[model samples]
Target: MKNVLRIIGAILGIVLAVYLVYQLRTIFVYIILAVVLSLLGRPLMNLLGKIRIKNFRLPNSLSALIVLIVMILFVVGIFSLFVPLIAQQARIVSSIEANEVARAFAEPLNRFSQFLADYELTEERFDEHYFRAQIRDILKFGKVSSVFQSIFGVLGNLFIAIFSVLFMGFFFLRDGMLLQRILETLVPDAEVPHVRVILDNTKRLLTRYCFGLVIQVALVTLIISVSLKFFLGIENALIIGFMAGLLNLIPYLGPVMGAILGVIIVMLTNLDLNFYSELLPKSGWILVIFACMQLFDNMITQPVLFANVVNAHPLEIFIVISVAGTLYGITGMIIAIPSYTVLRIIAKELFSQYKVVSSLTRNL
Candidate 1:
């Protein structure tokens, strides 16, 4: 009877939790953005606070304002420089004749068709009609539309996120410590110390992660842009590199996508060059730059900068990304590691205080 009651209670609790989550999703998004932005800006805010005292002249608020202005200027400068160039390149790509791409792929496709023809298939059936039609049908019938809808749904959420970050940054910079005290107040006396420890650890880890990401993005963008410019004379090196760096935020698959796009840009622009000899090598340089950047990020930048923050093993990280992607698409994938880290912190803190749960899950 007791076991039956417990199961019933668990089911009810889960249902209630799901309902509450659905109801509060909008509000929760704002809170999440606030937390993420605080993590991003805290280090700079703290540094400015310290330097004010050291200088004995400027106020901390003044220093912080200066930092904000400089950050805004740098972001705006990059956007203004790259946006127009990328737009122009995109127009060029769109203006190219579809026949050009078809011509490029025709020879390999012809050979492929011949290989299939030996098995009683023809080029029309294999390459032009059925195969492509089947691919389109599969996409139309399968999960592609849903995935695209979810992607656009996430894009729509960006406004809420931006507003939340701005709202949160104001209070986070001004009264973040006070907010921590208030959170501590919500916990029971016995759990307050554990909660505090968890919060402290999370703050430190997330701050380090954000800082490391910034450095990594900057370094990779510079490397890609410079290498492409020097080696290929690519006119839109900065834009291509910037796009690559931004996409690198998506993790493992990002570099591959970036490299493909970079190659396409080179191919479209260099109409005069030998397709395989000169164009391929120029495209190959993008891949080389990507490799070098990944090497530095994985070895030096990540270890030196984000050592303590992202403590999970590669397999654990991979599982988290895969699961998150499966559940909620790119937004989920982008945030998977951080979400896992936060959950781990909370679980560790709780389990440390409760021996019963710890003992039951000894393997974990």
Candidate 2:
């Protein structure tokens, strides 16, 4: 009877804990973001600490504040550089005439429709008029205005999230050991050493992973932008490059999406050109460029990142990303690596006796 009562009590406690966590999910997200930022910013904080002026050193709080300010400025600079380009693209898209665009692509579209019919792949002939009407509906002035308004609404929410993260990160950086001490208190005395090992390994691996990701994104963006500008004479090269690089965060699906988006943008903006003579050929080249970029990323950047920084096998990373994407979508895929890394560390620490765990985390 005592054992039954204890089991019931334990189940109730688990239920209550899950419910509380669900209710405070937003706060949890903020805390996680703060922790990541603090880890990423630790080197900067340490560098600031090394600056001593005649037996006086900057306080940790002040150092954190300076790092925060620098981060904010860097973010603001990025926005300032990209916002005008995005606005210009929005205006151009809004001004495009669906009828004209349809006329430009009519020949190739008709050919495609005939091919589909020839292959018995489609039941109805593709209708350019219907396509034009759909495009017109999408590009209507009110629709465009509403789209911009929705974007602004999302940006407002993002700003709030960013500010909250920065606020929490400042304290985390200043009191670096405070979180560790708190965790130690929460764990059983015997498990405290294991928890510390997990935490330390997690921090080290995640910090390197974060820095590696930044380098990967920047390298991809530079490669695409420079290639497009120099080889293709594409006017919106920077915007396309940035979009592709940002989409690359989605793992397997990302490069494909980026390629498609790049081709579509190039085609849409150059609708005045003959479809077969100029637009299609140019768009194909753009795709080839993006494909090469993805090849470089996969062959070079990703191998180095996974092998050295995250210290995970390529196959392991792929399996983790695939499963996470299947279950939780793009966001899941983006975070799969770091989350898997942490899980591996914890598993190795707690279950070192298991041969599988020992083998999997031998490097870690």
Candidate 3:
């Protein structure tokens, strides 16, 4: 009876905690971003700390501030370079008329729909006017004014989020032990030492993983951008390439998603061209380029970076990411490896006696 009471109490506590977390999710997001920034900046902070000039070493606060500034500058520089270009291209694409696009491609769409109908694949006949309306509906949100309006609408929340992340990130970087101290208070006194071990292990692993991830994203972005610039002469190649690199963060499914997006963007921008001869062929070539990129990533990039950084097998990473994606979607897939790494470390520390834990965390 006592055990049952204890179990029920624990369940209720968990439920309440989850409710609180959901309610305060925005704050949690800020904290998580700060933690990720700190993780990425830690090595730079340490390196700065080691600098000496005439028996003078940089203070923690100064080092942390410098690191934070450098990170901010890096992000700002990238945005400054790409944002205007992308925005201009977006304006141009948004100004495109749905009737113009529909007039150019409507026949092909109808023929494809008729083929489907002929094969009894779809009972509904494709209407040209309906198709043009659909095109207008799709392009409505593609309007530059609409896009900027959406962003403007969220400016207040966005500012708060950015400021909160920056504020917390500075402190986290400055006081390397800040996060540890917070955890120490939350963790039980008896289990503090064990928890500290888990924290250190998780941080070290995640730091390496994050570094490798940034490098991977950079390499992918450079390749795709260069390929499109030189091979296809696309105007907004950088935008598409950056998006592809970002999406490639997800395993298995991300490359295909990026490819589809690439096709859409290409088609949208090239709407004035011949659909079958120029536009369709260009879109096809995009698929080929993305396919080649995938092959290269699978053959060279992923194996080298992730295998070393995560210390897990391909199959293991795939299963974990797939399960996470199923449960929590794109965000889950993005965080799956780090989450799995931390879970494995915890299991190895606390449940090493169990055979399954031992087997799964063998690399760790």
Candidate 4:
């Protein structure tokens, strides 16, 4: 009777905790951002600490402030560089005429439609006319002003969020164990050692993973930009490269989406060219470039980041990412491996007696 009651009480506690977390999700977001900032900024903080004038070194507060400013400037610089390019592309897509696009591709599109019909692949007729309608639907964005207005509306509280995150991040960088100290107060005194170990392991693993992501994005961007520049006649190769790099954040599915986007943009830019002989050739080369990039990424980069850095098996990472993507979508997929790594660290400390936990966290 006592055991049954205890089990029910435990389940109720878990439910209540989840409910509270959901209510305070925004605060959690800020904390997560602060933690990430602290991780990224810690190296700079260490470097600043080593700098001295005679016998005096930089203070922790001063170091943290410098690190914070540098990170902010980097972020602002990235936005400044990319935002205008993106906005320009969006304007081009939004303002382009569907009729003109259809007319440009009409000959090849008609031939392709006939091929599909001859093969009985399409149920109803599919031709340039059907594609012409899709052109408007696919590229439709009312205006750039309206789009940024919606973005500004959504980020209305962005100032407060940034300030809160920076404040927390400064302290986190100043005192590396600040997060662990806070977590300790929540757990029992007996569990303090476990919490400390968990936080330490998570920090190291996540730092490597985060840096790996940066390298991957930059490398992918470079490959795509170079490919488009030399192999294709596209005018907006830089913007397309940036788009591919950003979308590559979504694991497994990202490369395919990037390829499709590359093709679409290729068609859009070369509307004045002959679709069959001229445009098609360029599009084919772009796909080949994307394919080669993906092959390199999958074979080399992903294994190192997702498997080696996290100390998890490749199959284990795949399953975890798949489940997270199914449950919470793209954002979930992006964070899945890191989140799972943290969970494994915690479980190793707290549930090592369990066989499954022991096996999964054996590497950690």
lDDT of 1 at 114: 79
Off by over 4 Å in 4: 1-19, 111-125, 134-149, 157-161, 305-307
* Residues 95-206 of candidate 2: C-alpha lDDT, one tens digit per residue: 7788988887788778888899999998877768767888888878899799989999999999899989998999999988877898899867997988788888878888
Model 3 stretches with alpha carbons more than 4 Å out: 1-24, 139-149, 313-315
Query: Taking the tens digit of each residue's C-alpha lDDT, what string does model 1 give over 1-364?
Result: 9867855875696588658855896676577766766667666777766654444855545654565556668777978988898889878875655455545545545667878888876545445444444545544635767877887998888766766666666666655675578778976788788878888988887877777778878877888888889877888899888988888878787777788888877777775676567766777877887788778777887778766777666887899899888877877787787777776776666654457545432322
Residue pairs clashing, model 1: none
How many steric clashes between backbone atoms does each model show? 0, 0, 0, 0
Better of 1 and 2 by lDDT: 2
Candidate models: Cα lDDT each: 0.72, 0.85, 0.85, 0.84
Per-residue lDDT of 91 in model 2: 87
Q: What is the lDDT of residue 221 in candidate 3?
A: 90
Please give the distance, in angstroms, between residue 61's alpha carbon in candidate 1 and its true position after superposition.
7.9
Best by TM-score, which number? Answer: 2
- Candidate 4: Cα lDDT at 364: 80
Clashing pairs in 4: none
Cα error of candidate 3 at position 22, Å:
5.0
Worst-scoring 10-residue span by lDDT in model 3: 136-145
TM-scores, each model vs. reference: 0.75, 0.90, 0.88, 0.87
